[model samples]
Target: MADIHITIHNKTFATATEPTIADFTLSLVSGEFVCLVGASGCGKTTLLNIIADLDYDYDGDIVVGQQHKSPKIGYIFQNPRLLPWRTVRENIELALPDDYAGDVVDNLLDIMQLTPHQHVYADRLSLGMGRRVSIIRAFAVNPELLLMDEPFVSLDPPTARQVRALLLQLWQQRPHTVLFVTHDLREAITLADKLIFLSANPMQIISEVLVAIPRNERNNELAVENFRQQLLNEHPDIKQLL
Candidate 1:
C-alpha cells in the first residue's frame, strides 16, 4: 500500500510502550513529506531515533524501494547544533560528503537568501538564521532521507512560519523523502503531504490522513482554517490530539 514501507516491533526492558513504540506500521510514497504528530510524550522522538538507527534494540523492516546507490541520511535536531566557532559556510562544508556536488551549498544559500550571512559565525546569527543554516547543512550532502526532529520548535510563531516557507521552497527545488515530527497541528497542517496520528501510550499509528488541499492554496489563513475544519470533521479523532 506504500512506496516507502516500514514495520516496527519493540520489546523493551522497561515495559514502556509509549515512548518505546511497541507495535507500529507506517508507509509513505517516495519523495513525500510526512508529518508525525502525537501527544507530548507519545514516542515521536523515539520513533525518529529508531528510523535513524540511533536506537538498535527494535526489530523492524524498512523498504525504500530501488535506487542507484545507497541513500545518505540527514538529521536536523531541535537545535541548530552548528559549531559555535564555525562560519555558516564552513558549517555546511563540514557536512559535505566526497560525492557532494560542487555548487550544492551555494545553491542552497542563494535560495534561502543566506549567502549574505554565509561568512558570519554560527553564534553570531539569529535563531531563525541558525535554523536555516542547519537546514542547508542537511541538504548540502544531498541526503536521500531527511529526518527533522522539531527543527523550528524554539522559534517564535512568526519566525517559525518564515522558516517553514523557506523549507517549502527548498523541498520544491529538489524533493527529498522527509519525516518531520511535530506536536503543533497548525504547523503539521502547513507542512505535511500526509498526516500520521499515533495512540497515546503505545504510539501506534491510529490514522493516516492525506492533505489533499494544494500547497499553494494553503497559504491563506482562512483556507488553512477551512481545510483544518474539514480534517477535523472527517477524522474527528484528531480533535483530541489537537
Candidate 2:
C-alpha cells in the first residue's frame, strides 16, 4: 500500500461571505481508516468534497500519491444512490470498468453478500440490503481511496452495527484508504484507526487521536467503552451535539 499525504494550507471556501472551512491541514496514510467528526455546520462534507476533487475552487494543494495523478475515488453518500430501474447486480455492475464488467460484478456480489438479492430491484430491497448494494457498487471499481459521508446513517441501531461489521470485514479484505465522515463517536471509534475532531463553522482540525487497540480486539465491549471515555476526556469537544 502507498502512503497518501493531504495538506490543506490556507484553504477557504465560502458562499457569499460565509466561510465553510479555513486553514485546514491534515495528513492521512494509505490503508488507514480515518473518520472526521464534527458539528452540523463544521464543513465535514465540504472537506470531503475537496479531497474527492469534487470541489476544487478552494485555495490549497490536495495531493495524493507520488505521481500526483488523480487517484480513483469512490464516494458513498447518506442515501443509497442506486438506480431505481436497475437490479441489485446491475447497480453494482455500473461501477465496474466497461471491459471487465462480468467478472467484477460477480466477485463483488459474492463479497458483499448480495448474491441472493442479485436480481432484485432497488425499490424492492430493504434499507440494509440497499446499503449493501451501494457499498458493493462503490467497491466494484477498486478505488484507491473511498470517501463515505454517513453511509449507514439511515439504518436502525442493529442494522447499523451489522453494516459496520460488514464494512470492516470488506475493508480488511481489500485494504483501501478510507475517509468516513460521521457525527457518531462510537461509530468513528469502532471503524477508524485514526480519528479527527473538527470545530464548528469555518471548520479546522482541532485534534487527532490514534486508536492503538488492535482491530480484532475492538469488539470487546468493556475495552471499547473505556477507549471511548478516554477520547471524550482528551477531546471534550466531542461531547457537543452535532
Candidate 3:
C-alpha cells in the first residue's frame, strides 16, 4: 500500500471560480496522527468533508494507502451525534461493520472506563460521557482512517483532559491513521505528531511543524508546557491564537 495522499486543487462556494481551499496537499503514513489548524471559516471542515466523501464537488485526488480497494473511514464531529433512545453500547454497536464479529464495542468501553455505563441511555449521559460514546462509535468501525473535527471543543478543561487521555489510550492500542482538526494549539500540541497551519480564507497550508517529543512524554504538564512554550517562541503569531 502507498501512503495516503490528498491533493486539493480548489474548493468553492457560489461558483467554481470562487475558491475557499486552494492548492492544499497533505500526506499521511499509516498510523500517524496529524492535526490541522487555521483561522475560523477557513474551510477546515470543508476539507475534512471532502476527505470523508461527504462533499465531492471539489477537484482533488484522495489516494488511499491500504490494500482494500475502499478504505474504511470514521468521523467524530464537534457534537456527539448519538441516538437519545439508544444505550451507550447500542450507540457504538450501530456503527460496527456488517462483517465484524469480535467484541470490539465491549473492549473499547473497557479501555475508556465506560463499561459500567454501557446499559444507560445516551440522553442520560453527562457531556464527557456522551463524548466518550461518540468516540467509541467511531472506533467501533475499526476505521483505517479516522477524521475528527474538534470533538473536544466545548468540554470543560478537566473533562477534556480525561477524554484526551482516553483517545490516546485507544490510539496506542489500535494505532489507526488519524487526521484531527482543532482550534486549540495546546490540544494540537498534546496530540499531534505533525501540526499543519492554514492561512486565513483562501485556505492554504502555510506551515507544517513536526513535534519531536515522545508520545509517552506528551501528557506531562511540564513537558507539554515546555513544548507549548517552544511553539510560542518559534511562532510568536501563534500566541495571537489565530
Candidate 4:
C-alpha cells in the first residue's frame, strides 16, 4: 500500500488558451477508496491520465509511496480495451510480470465469476463481461495504486448493478489505493470512502465529502438514498456539481 501526493502547477493544451488544471493539489491515503466526480469533459480523465503516467506534458509532481518510491499502477479505462483476438485469460496474463504465478489470475477469475468464460475471446464477450476481464486484469497485477475511469458506464441497470457488486467484492478482498472517476452521484455515494467534486472549467476540486455510510450499508438503496439526501441537505451548493 502507498500513499500518493499530486501537485499540478498547470496543464494546458497547445491549442487552448487557458490551462485545464492550475495549482491543484490532492492526496490519497494508503488503501483508501476515493472517487472524483464532476460534469462531463471537466478534465477528470485527464487527471487520471496524469496520475497513471500515461500523459506527462503537464508541469506537476506526483509522489507515490514512501520516499517517492514508484508503485505499480493499474488503470481501468471506460472501455475494456482488451484485444479482440485474445482470450480473457490471455488478455489478463498480458499484464502479469514474468515471475508472477498463474494461480493469481485463476483466483481473480473465479472471484469475478469469470472462470467459466476465461477461455472466451474478448470479441465475443458482452460489455459487462469485458469490463469484468479488465477489472480482473488490473487486480491481477496487485497494484498499489488503481485508477478507474467510469468503468461502469453505458451498461443496463441489472448488468451495472452486478458489476458494481463484483467490483466492491474485489476491492474489499484487496484494498488498493483507488482513484475512481465517475459522473454518477449515486454510484459515487455507494462506492467511495470519500467523494471529491470538481468544478466545470479549469478542473479544480470544489468540495470534498466524506461518506458517512458504513461499508456494509452502502449497498442498501435506502441507506444510500438517506445519505445522499443528507449530503445535499447540508451542502446544497454541491448539488449542481453532482
Candidate with maximal lDDT: 4
Residues 163-228, candidate 1: write the lDDT tens digits.
Answer: 999999999997888899998877888899999988766678888888877999767778778888
Tell me which residue pairs clash in candidate 3: none
Q: Candidate 4 lDDT, tens digit per residue, 175-221?
A: 88999998888999999999998985698988899998888988799
For candidate 2, what is the lDDT? 0.81
Kindly give the stretch of ten consecutive residues in candidate 4 with the minimal lDDT sum. Answer: 63-72
**Model 2 worst lDDT window (10 residues):** 7-16
- Candidate 4 or 3, higher TM-score: 4
CA displacement after TM-score superposition, residue 184 of candidate 3 (Å): 0.7
The window of 10 residues in a row where model 1 has the poorest summed lDDT is: 63-72
| lDDT of candidate 3 over 1-242, digit per residue (tens) | 24688888978876546689888888888888999987778789998888888888887788786442335688999999999999998888888766776577778899999999999999999999988999888888877789999999999999999999999999889788899999888889899989988875678877788988898888887887898789878887765446
Best by TM-score: 4
What's the distance in Å from true for residue 117, model 2?
Answer: 0.6
Task: TM-score each candidate.
Answer: 0.92, 0.92, 0.93, 0.96
Q: What are the per-model numbers of colliding residue pairs?
A: 1, 0, 0, 0
Model 1 TM-score, all chains together? 0.92
In order, the Cα lDDT scores of the candidates are 0.82, 0.81, 0.85, 0.89
Candidate 1 overall lDDT versus native: 0.82
Candidate 2 lDDT over 124-169, as tens digits, reads 9999988888887787778888899999988999999888888888
